[model samples]
Target: MITDMTQGNPTKTIIKFAFPFLVGNLFQQLYNIVDSVVVGRFIGTDALAAVGSSFMIMNFFSFVIIGLCMGSSAVYSFFFGKKDYVSLRKSVFISFFSIGIFTIVLSILIILNTNNMLLLIKTPQSILEGSQDYLEIIFGGLIFVFLFNACSALIRSVGDSKTPLYFLILSAAINIVLDLVFVVEFNMNVEGVAIATVIAQAVSSILCFIYAFIKIPLIRLHREDMVFDREISTMVAKYSILTSLQQSIMTFGMVCVQGIVNTFGPDTIAAFTAAGKIDSIAYLPVQDFGNAFSTYIAQNKGAKNNERIHEGVKSAARTIIVFCLVLSTLIFINSENLMRIFVKANESNVINLGVEYLTIISVFYMLIGFLFMFYGYFRGIGALNISLVLTVISLGTRVLMAYVLSSIPTLGQRGIWWSVPLGWALADSVGLIIYKRLK
Candidate 1:
């Protein structure tokens, strides 16, 4: 499964490797969007808002799992490039094992605080009970999220992005079918959506676990190969923890913004939720590419090719610009129709609010593209400090703007929407500075 990335045409190789990830990420997003769509249409807007308000919290831990797995994947990419299978497997096992332990405890703590946390986010009184039902189920299934990410990271680190995509498709299908059956047929609302997600994720995690252990020769560990290296663990931990903190910090800022949006009541929250899903899907292609670039850089870094890393970053930038231009244009023209994907006929205000948010965000889509590119570039090369600094700055800018702007009586809810681009602009500016100075 370990393909030689160091030998291929840089741009083609990067895109080829990243493409499955792009598709995989789309299916991944479907898991969330389908939930919103089903709940909004069948269960109503309040149910949709209940699920929406919890996105920041639900995703916070998911990001933690992803960041750590990403760090492990970096380690795997490095060692795989060096043909150091022993150390690669060891790091993989340790990371996989460690996150399993960590997520269980975290899940328990999160479940305990689910209600209070929703309260802190200012979830409306009407949506409170449904939010609790949804979040408790998600947090309890954190193990599925953690383990699947670990398995996928290890496999992809050795150049098998397609494998994960297969399982993602399987999971998406399962989640969609289950979403309909439980929510529509059984008259279950938020609980059905939550249960469907956990079940689908669990299946994917099991499949990934099976494939990695059976098909991937690199992961076929022996008793002797189980040597836990402290140095390797420490190094993996260094990258993983730092990246996790970076993601968590960014999510923390979004949670603050979610709190601001919540104050405007359920309709606005429902609107934000719907629009945010579209916004997330739009950014996903670049994220997958950024991740692809990271693996590309890690392997090439292991090969000692600094030039390829630079070339890859440039390649990623071109891809981002071209894609964003097209995507933003499409979204601008079809903003209303897109918003309708999650809102019903009666939810006209929700539709209008979503259109407003989507319009503002599209204008700065290119800026967001640049922001992701640098973040991906820095992360690929293990420029953890730089990545952390950019994310923190972006987070602070977003949080401050959310509070300061949204507090203005005139701006109110629109202020929450505008805060997004301001944060992105500031972050993009700083990231550009770093890229220019360093280059």
Candidate 2:
């Protein structure tokens, strides 16, 4: 097997790189699916809504990790492309040190003011206690999340996507079993679900770290590698911080959107949550490809091969278009059947609402593919600033629309849901235009 990411045809290279990433992503989503199922099936809709609402808050934290890790990955990719093993090691070490400091600060802030922050979000009192409980546990386990992401990011940066996938699969299986035992058999409710996720993530992080430290020779750190190079470290930090800002802004925008969803009561929240999961599943392919393209472009950029970078962007765009066309067609064809899998309401209102929202969003799914491709391409080239600017604009549009559009009586909740695809399409158009001019 061609394990190292540096050698291969761009198309084959990306496919090879993307396969495990796809699997890992699937397992990751399982974490969400398991939580939703257990909550909806055992604890009831309000409980499910609590889990969903808390998820938006958690997603913001997720974006921070993604930003930092992506920045590190890009730097590592450049070093890997140049075949500068020493520089790659230094980049990884500096990144690990930086993330430890950053996560500790964030964890302290979260633990100290969990209630205050929850109250600020206008989290409904009905679900407040449960959501708070879940958040507290998840927050405490922040290091595990960061540990997995940083290590996985570093490994993927050097082109070892498969190893991470293996661990993800193992941990996902553990999560499912734990969820059954704790939530289903024992009836521990939201806290049980939270415990399951943290434990699973911790396990994956430990296994991933062990695998990389022992098996993947590139990552084994030495004293010499621990010394950070100021220029490379600075460059990595600048790009990573911008990217992190972009992700945080996007998550913050979603929090605003969730506020809008909350106004409609738990039913709408449950429906929207279910619909969001379906959308995430549909998005997996394009997102998977987008992730692959980032590494692909990063490696090619490091080689200073401009045309291959262009090829990667074009290929990714085409793949996303095809994928959306198929997925949207399927959702349209069997919307009811799909929603039933998540939330099976006797009246079918929740599922119907979800299907309607999903159908509307599907219209613009192709635009998401374009946006991810453009962002990945630019980010790979260390032009992450462009990606950050685009995300800020995109997030701003979503938040403004959620506030203004959802209030319109005629559109109401539909508008709140509809704003999603519309925002993606509008923002993605800007990204494509910018990429065209820059490339």
State which candidate has the highest lDDT: 1
Per-residue lDDT tens digits for candidate 1, residues 281-322, read 987887788788888888988888888888877788888889
Candidate 2 lDDT, 1-439, residue by residue in tens: 1255545576677877888998899999987898898888878888888988898888888779777887788888888887888888888889888987899899878878877766777778899898889999988898988899888988888888888898899888989999889988998989999999999999999988887777777779989888878987897798678778877888888888888888888888889888888888887877778877888888877788888788766667667777789888887777778778778568377887888888888777787877777778778887888888777777777777877888899888888876777678777888878877887
lDDT, residue 245, model 1: 86
Model 2, which residues run further than 4 Å from truth?
Answer: 1-7
Global local distance difference test of model 2? 0.82
Against the true structure, candidate 1 reaches a TM-score of 0.98
Question: Weakest 10 consecutive residues, lDDT, candidate 2?
Answer: 1-10
Cα-based lDDT for every prediction: 0.87, 0.82
Query: Evaluated with TM-score, which candidate comes out highest?
Result: 1
